[model samples]
Target chain A: MGKALAAAIGLASIAAAVTAPTAFGQPPPGAAACSGCHPASARVTSPVVRLAGLERDAIVRAMQGFRSGQRAGTVMDRIAKGFTDDEIQALAAWFAAQPKGGEEGNPARVPLPKGGEEGNPARVPLPKK
Target chain B: MTFTRRRFLGLAGCTALFPAPARGQGAGPRVVVVGGGFGGASCARALRQLDPRVSVTLVEASATFTACPFSNAVIGGLRELSAQQFTYARVAADGITLVPAMATAVDPAAKSVTLADGTRLPYDRLVLAPGIDIRWGALPGYDEAAAALMPHAWKAGEQTLLLRRQLEAMNDGGLVVIAAPANPFRCPPGPYERASLIAHYLKTKKPKSKLIVLDAKDAFSKQRLFQAAWAELYPGLLEWVPLSKGGAVTSVDAATRTLVTDFGKHQANVASVIPPQKAGRIAEAAGVTDRTGWCPIDPVTFESTLQRGIHVVGDAAIAGAMPKSAFAANSQAKSCAAAVVTLLAGGTPAAPKLINTCYSLVAPDYGISVAGVYAPSGGQLADVPGAGGVSPANAPRATRAAEAVLAEAWFHTITGEVFG
Candidate 1:
């Protein structure tokens, strides 16, 4: 019964996750919560483009750039390909409405298990000549 | 699974069972596709879109899909995991029979597949796109239990959510360790993408938190591209230990959260072990594992040489010069679908051209890729010269940024093609 219950819960979460509302169909508050890393603050001089100051239209335009091969050979094309037109707008709106440094919404990390370890490691063999 | 006009008729006969007739009409040949990731979804959907006569049934273990392709952006906070999801409804809406069941075994001789629930699904042509499977015990001390404590999150589902939750909940200044398996696995650039995204989160959310990558390969899929991005964009926050430096993890004690390496033992606050992979177990059980853990297929037909009537595509079938990528799987699925359709239409499979270009996002504006177009030569698929290859290592920064955007667009287009 315990195993069955656990499996039930596992399956339930699996279902919930697949249908999670925060990000799949529309950009939820979560998308807005990541602007601190690359905000387009006037003082912010990241070589990376900042999405914070961009409007919904611009962000969508940027994503579309990747899609039509205009922004050729870029990963943005791959990322942009993941959403529907409606969902893309939601993401753009959610992010565009935010100010620079608007980061939040990260949950706490579950402690690593006593036996949990890296699948493969590479930093230890004596350095090869 | 001999192709016949009668089999196609039977497929048409089942549509009467649906409330609404699918987008296509008539009985086509019978095609059973297992797994709904890029490959299964693509093959099944393509069969219907390319040729309406074929009856396509897709058996996916889950109703909804959490794509591995861009889950990294979810990790980075640049994109939501929801954006990386699709429903089997798209496949169903496209008139493919979408079955939510795990494919357990295949009887190639009988041309039938046994589902986990003991349903026997017979087919004229069986397409197995169950993706790659983790050889669990390949790394000692790591088992399913250990995964709970430290998630591999390789298959892309709730653990993806769980990993995201853990990343969220970790205290600022915390340490997150990512252990990447050696090459020839699903989504070659996934680990680096994960690290970059995770570091992006840590840099902002935790401030002092760090992302440590313990990689098993000598160098990564796009080492220079990733290194340049990490240095200029995420310096001091992301660190990588390559295989040459003892980054190859030999074993793990999930209970102890300790990883044993040739160098020594070190523990982390969080660990994700993506083990060495093989063709999904059904393929192995169906007699597909060669000296390598993958099946070598005739690129033209994607037929399993070891067995008749079964074709393996995606990460299961080995195609040279093609990384085991989502784009490759989707492309392979289309070719497989075309071949199956041609044979069903009372014709021989055509000599096919397969195309794939995988995008890895470093930042929203930064991306890199490897593109290839393949044709059969000397019993194997070879990249057509000047058609596809890795993005130039020394591309201008702006160009790299452009590729990142294109990568996202490609993801949208390809996934739409499959599950849209």
Candidate 2:
């Protein structure tokens, strides 16, 4: 039984290393922070728009707009001025490659436990006027 | 006690219930995370997500975590305590071992954590996200017992409800006093937000009551925005006393509900004295804390400067220029997780870029925020030039309402990420 357990553990480790999800590529330095406010999960309803699966050019254009004060945002303008053009390009490309469904996104989304909805106000839709 | 075929099958079935990939039950580097708040929980989950081969264990004292982000809303009667409460069922379901026991001691040399129940958890890396603990005797006449009479409500659970009940039970024309702490505390803008929400509660529920904020700092985060909203929404109801104006509370008399400042002593019907704070007790026990009572870390990796193999994140860490807010904590945790993964694989971790956005609601519909991008510089984290600042002063009402909605959204999205 002990030998069997050892073999199973060894096989699992090898499988994990071989199937590691680095195939999706690593995210840029500051890219993970964007999902703090922007919903990575389609299941999460928020006023902030999700950046996953956006056109790389579109994301770059919006960031440039915020940086140059051409676009108006409550917080994005301040945040955009922090990144260089190269960093922005890298982030845009990384986010654009993420799956829109959110499973294979920058900030990986996990399945909530049963009745976890009660703690997540974002899951509820905002009231319409 | 002999192993039978049926027994072997049952064992296999149990192992099948937890997939080996997610659980990292294979031979790999082990990580043990203490404290299940935004920092610790995010790190534990991020470690698993980053490399499923790494075994992760989260040791939290409580079954449920009460988040401090929206806890002020609870004190203002704008939210329920249940909305701020979350369980670790999802974190456990992700296959990390969840230990619901207080971590008592750390043997850094041995790389093991001793729990209150006498179980020792061995680990290759230890991440301490213990958050902040109130400095009990730092303020004269304010200790654990004094908290019963004059609640701080800083730590969020029972104290949050206590302060709310005090506000609810106060007389219609009563006075509410909030004593704000000095620099380098958890949530730089929290005291002001608490003051705003308490004023909102007073305006709607007890029209004749008044609130005064005794600030230990002359200026605070988003100061102009908060002051502007106070003038427009709560002109006569709320008053702010800056430190230069003798606003610093020197001591407290809980029984009499009196706050003594350098100028004079003021008695209030309800007193919320936010005392001095330091890193949580566990960090000190682990011998990672410095003279500042906070752990100093390598800004890029969050590895303790004083201790090897132990990383500190969240409010317990002295992250330069980054306010000790939940958003910053979560961001730091992710960076720490990434660095830990690389280090375990015998690779050098790259410099990390981090961000923090903190929203303060002046009213249920009026909100303001400060955002910043940060990177490692000069051996500490520094704000990226021209990248972050407070909300524009004198913005239109529509903008304020929009920010308020976004503030709620930020809360939901962040809490969902960390706890959901």
Candidate 3:
């Protein structure tokens, strides 16, 4: 179910990327509050997932689940219940507005040099052992 | 800088009396932050993230930030001290000026901070996140010299290493005692978690060993859940003595590893003496701390209620009901950053919703947690009704295991948010 939703969001994001150069308006001021847990848009290794470039509607729906206690969360349920509907909407729009892969304003998606010859010489893999 | 009386009139109540930067004379709002722990680092980064126009200078005494949240894991040998360590590289990379100096004094009226090296940093606003400093001499015989022998391990880094070393050196079937402090300490669940983790180490490594927790408080956060877990997972290995039962460690003789209480004295192969703490000395030096040894701040803006132009966050600030945890510090920092931005822009600060989630590992793969969402109510941060709770006591093992994963995840994510 999670994969299916991700695939659907992927398709929608591609379409939105092509049609609308921007996702929404300026990032919400309170959006930084979420940064304390979800650092940036980039995929983080921690269990607490990132929220940089998810679909606005999906983000809103997820927050609504947390708010209503329909979603099982370690901490988000309590945190979401504190926000008003409007604040959640603003948060969703702000996160969604960030460009996914690499964009000027998005701090999360700084591209890493692919490994092998393209990466730093110190980290370059040696010949096959 | 020019003393423009009229310009200061509009921001009378909020802004302190300082030479207002002449129009376009200076670049932007200059915010100077002290202490580079969760609170200071998060506030510095959030200020720049929220508003690029603001210039942030973070004054941290240490080069690397050692997180207290996961220090217990380090003590238990589950995690390395390196894992709990963080650098200011990310904050500096994010455009905040990282000042490696100890802040000695904060002059609110002049809006300047004096560092140890005699560097006076001027600021439009100052944010103080000086984490707790142990109130030496409060607990008789528990001083710096004693801490060297009976490590507190509360501040992380060297003390944590000292505790770990002591545990590793101790023999099997030995008695490990932890003297926990009274209420309003840095982390409410920390001492228990340390006891649990230490018990796990002793059980796995030294099966015959025993653990004792001598707590000053009668009860603790998540008492039922912790007690239940101990009975189930580490039965006969752990014991807890509350204050009513003569638990408080009134004094410590580090030379002999003996803790003296009103009832009697208890000796141990190894001991952890967590002394009472207060707001960092800088807060007191600045005259922000009151009789309670904590700085009072406006819940809405985190501006010092005792003095203007200075805001305190993290363990030092009296944040109403918020526990002094890394999560609370980071949350308060974000809100404080926003308030600084809004107030500097000549706008009224909006009410903020603060959140905190403190997770403790009872044993490896056994976790318990308490979460809360707070809002400004009657000039203090109050827990929103029906928005906070502790993990269920009788929950399934799977639930506890999942929470353990979340607990690990929370440590990494929060450290990244604050320092990364």
Clashes of 2: 0
- Model 1 Cα lDDT, one tens digit per residue, B179-257: 8998788778889888888877777778787777888998777778789889988999988998899988998887656
Rank by lDDT, highest first.
2, 3, 1
Who is ahead in DockQ, 1 or 2? 2
The interface root-mean-square deviation of each model, in the order shown, is 19.3, 14.4, 13.7
Better of 1 and 2 by lDDT: 2
The predicted structure with the larger TM-score, 1 or 3, is: 3
Tell me the lDDT of model 1 at A124: 21
Highest DockQ model number:
2
Q: lDDT of model 2 at residue B130? A: 99
lDDT of 2 by residue, B331-357 (tens): 999889988877666555667779999
Q: Which ten residues in a row have the lowest lDDT in candidate 2 chain B?
A: B8-17
| Range of the 10 consecutive residues with the lowest summed lDDT in candidate 1 chain B | B12-21
Q: Model 1: how far is B303 from its true place, Å?
A: 0.6
Highest TM-score: give the candidate number: 2
For every model in order, the fraction of real contacts preserved is 0.01, 0.41, 0.27
